[model samples]
Target chain A: MDALKAMWETVPPATPDDLARARRRLIEEMGGRRRLITVPRLLVAAAAAAAVVIPLINGLGTPAYAVTKNPDGTITVTVNELRDPAGLEAELRSVGIKADVSFLAPHTRCAGPRFAGVDPSYGTRPHTEAELKWGAEHWRSLQVIKAIPAGHRIGIHPEYIRPDETLVLEIRDDQNPKVLWTLGAWLAEAGTPVKPCTPVKD
Target chain B: MTSQVDADDATLIGRSLDDPEVFAALFDRHAPLLHRYAARRLGPSEAEDVVADTFLAAFQRRGDYDRGRPDARPWLYGIASNLIGKRRRAETALYRAYIRSGVHPAEIPGAQVEDRLDTLAVNRPLARALLALKPADRDVLLLVAWAELSYQEVAAALAIPPGTVASRLNRARIQIRHALEEGD
Candidate 1:
C-alpha cells in the first residue's frame, strides 16, 4: 500500500498552461468584473424576510417585494415572490441603488450572456423543448437571476456592481424548470449610501 | 502584507467573491496535487479534464463553500473524486494497463529501476483489489490510502459519517489483504 501511494504521488502534475487556462475560464464565466460593494446593513435587514413564496403574483397583481430604506444608510429589498423583477429594480432605484436585475434560469438551456465556462456538473437536468423554446426568446429578458442551487434570492453575482456603476442582477425560480418570473430592477447609480428615512417621533 | 499563499482557502474564496482573479491563486496552490491524484486514478489526459472540472465546479460553488473549514483539500478532493468516479471505467482500464505493461504513462522514466519490479508486484495486486471493491468501498479506501485523507477528512469528502468511513475502510482493507494473499 505504501509503495502504491508513493507511485501514485510520483505521477506528474498538470502543466502550467492547463492551470492558467482553467483559471482564465473561471474568471470569464464568473463575469470578469470587480466585486460589488456589499451593503451589510441592508443584508442584515433583508435576511429575515428572504423566503420563497409560491404563486409569485400577489392577489393585487402587483410585483411582490418590500423595499425599505434601512436606518443604516442602506436600502433593503426583500423578494418574497418574483412576480416582476423589473418592478423590484424600479423600487431599488427609487431608493437610489442604481441597479439592474435579471433572473438566472437554473437550467442553462436558454440563450443569454455567454460565460467563458460553466460547471457542467451543477444545476438540474436539461430543459424540455417547450422550456428551451421559451428560454430562447426570453432568456436575456426573463426575470429570475438567482437559481435555487445558490440557496438565496439575492441575485447572480450582485457583487459585480461597481461603486460608480449600476447593479445588474439575474434571479431564478427555485422550482424545477426554474424560469425568469420577474424583471426585477435596474438602479442607475450604485455605491452611494441610501439616506436613512426621517425618524418619526411616536 | 499577507500574500495569497499565506491566506487559507476560505479567505481566498472570500476574496474571490470580490476580486475573482484572486481565486486563481487557489488553483496554483492545489491543482498540481489534484492533477497528480487524478492521473494516478485515470491517465494524464483524463486527469487534465478532472483537474479543470474540479476547479471550475469549486469556483462556481464557492459561494456555498463552508468557511468553517479552513482547509479546502477535502472539498477539492471531494469534487475531483466525483469527476473521477464518472470515468470509473477509465480508471480501471488504467490500472489494468499498468498491470499488463508494468508502465505508467506518468511514471518518471529511468529512475528507481531497482524498485520498479517491487512496486509493480504490489501495484498489480493493489489494482486488482481496487477493481474488485464496490464503488463506495473503493471511494473510502482510496481516499484514505491514496489521497492520505484522514478518516474524518474522508467523511467530509464523501459526506459520510466518520464511523461509516471506519467501517468501509476496514472492509476495504480486509478485501485488499485477502487479494494480496491470493496473489502470494
Candidate 2:
C-alpha cells in the first residue's frame, strides 16, 4: 500500500505552458462577452430602475427591457434585448422580489451552484433527458423565468419564490430574432447570497 | 499583498462570479495535483484530457459548489472521480500493463538501481491487485493512498456515506491483501 503511494511520485506538476493552454482556451471561449463586459460601464446604481425599462435604444427604439407587475402577482419582463442585468435585478427587487439577473451572450452560461438552491431543482445534475424534463425544467423550484409563447417575455411567479430566497436568472442571447432567447432560472437558498454571474463556456 | 493567494477556495469561487477570469487562479492552484492523480490512473496523455475536462465541468457547476467547505479538493476530486470512472477500462489497462512489464511509464526512475528492483517487485503485485479490484473499491483505496484524502473527504468526494467509504475501503484492502498473498 505504501509502495502504491509512491507509484508515480515524479511525473512533475503540469508546466506553465500546459496550464496556459487550458487557461487560454477558457478566456477565448469567453472572448465575445469578455469584451462586452469591458465597454465603458453605465453608473447604474442610484438610477437603476429607469435602466430596467428604458435601457439602450435598439435601432428601432424599443426599450431594452420592460417589467410589468401583473394583476396575478406575477411579473412580466418583456426583453427587447439582453442587456442591463443590474437594472433588471433592481426592477425585480422593486417589484417586491429579491433577484439576480445575468444577460449572457450566445454560447455562454453562468457557472453554477451560483447560489445555494432552495430545492432539488439545483441539487444534482440530471443524468438523463427524462430526469431533466421531470426534475429541473418542469419543477416548481424553477419558474423565475419561463418563456411566454406569444412574445419575447418571461413570467416571474413570485409565488414560487419565498421571502428569503432570491430569484436567480441567466438570460442568454440566441441571436435569431425568431427564437428571441433562452433562459435558466433557480432560487438561491434563503439567507445565502447569490454570486454575481460569471459567464463561461456553455 | 498576496490577497488572492490568501483567499480560500470558497472565496476564490465567490470572487470569480463577478470576475470570471479569477477562476483561472483556481486551476493554477489545484490542477497540478489533480493532473498527477489522473496520470497515475489513466497515463499522461489521457490524464491531460481528464484534468481539462474535470476543470471545465467544475467551472460549469461552480454555482452549485458548497461555500461552507473552504477547500475544494473533495469536490474537485469527486468530479474527477466521476470523469475517471467513465474511463475505467483505461485505468484497468494501466494497472495490467504495469503488472505485465513492471513499469509505470509515467513514473520517473530513481537513482538507486538496486532499490528499483525491490520496489518494482512489490509494485508489480500491487498493480495486479489494483487491476483486479472493482472500480469503485479502487477509487476509494487509491483516493486514500495516492490522493491522501481522509475518510470524511473520501466520502464527500465520492458522494457516498462515510460508512460506505469505510466498507468499500476495508473491502478493497482485504482484496488487495488476498491478491498480494496469492502473488507471493
Highest TM-score scorer: 2
Evaluate every candidate with DockQ and list the scores: 0.29, 0.15
Model 2: DockQ score: 0.15
Superposed on the true chain A, the predicted chain A of model 1 yields a TM-score of 0.39
Global local distance difference test of model 1: 0.61
Query: Against the true structure, whose DockQ is highest?
Result: 1
**Displacement of the residue B183 alpha carbon in candidate 1, Å:** 2.4
- Backbone clashes for every candidate come to 34, 6
lDDT of 2 by residue, B42-142 (tens): 88878888888888888778888899999999999999999999998898888888877877767776748888787777778788888888889999999
TM-score, candidate number 1: 0.58
In candidate 1, residue A26 scores what lDDT? Answer: 60
How far residue A139's Cα lies from its native spot in candidate 1, in Å, is 34
Candidate 1 chain A, run of 10 with poorest lDDT: A116-125
- Interface RMSD for each predicted structure: 12.0, 11.7
Q: If you assessed candidate 2 against the hidden native complex, which CAPRI class would it receive?
A: incorrect
